[model samples]
Target: MPIRTTETTVTLDHPFALTSFDSVLPAGVYRLEIDEEEISGLSFSAYRRISARLHTPAIGVLSSIREALPIDTRELEEVLKADRTPIILPAGE
Candidate 1:
């Protein structure tokens, strides 16, 4: 089961790339368009991604790492900021 699915679409000033635990999204902004769950004492989730050819395209699907990971969680809205910091999930989760 999934707790929820989240999507945050934002315009990038330049080409952007976001790398998550199991997925990577290459530079693209959706001008015309855009775009999880749990277990035991721990939570595990799976997600299916959709992409827009005209606007933003999904680079890959992502799954939360279940073992030896810190589970770095950030808002998509935050990552797409002008700072352009890379998203890194710590191990030992």
Candidate 2:
């Protein structure tokens, strides 16, 4: 039973919320950690994602307590995609 962990930083320009979090997270860099397990009985090495963790309070925010909140990969992807997509302002302001 071999397990692998990958870490990456994700930046969000706008505040967002995740199901795992109690409140909306401020816009900033967040640490994302993904854990996977190697699939057995395969000629080629393959890994399946087991869990994902998102660091709270962003990377630069000052807080007494920091927590790694569990998150779903799919939901995280959706939030990232939404963050990347520009908001369309129709008509006159």
Which candidate achieves the best lDDT against the true structure? Answer: 2
lDDT of 2 by residue, 1-93 (tens): 799999999999999998998889899999999999999999999999999999887887899999998999999999999999998898895
Error of 2 at 50 (Å): 0.3
- Give the per-residue lDDT digits (tens) of candidate 1, residues 45-85: 44433322222342232345222212223434455664376
For each candidate, C-alpha RMSD in Å?
Answer: 14.5, 0.8
Clashes of each: 6, 0
In order of appearance, the predictions have TM-scores of 0.26, 0.95
Q: Report lDDT (CA) for all predictions.
A: 0.40, 0.93
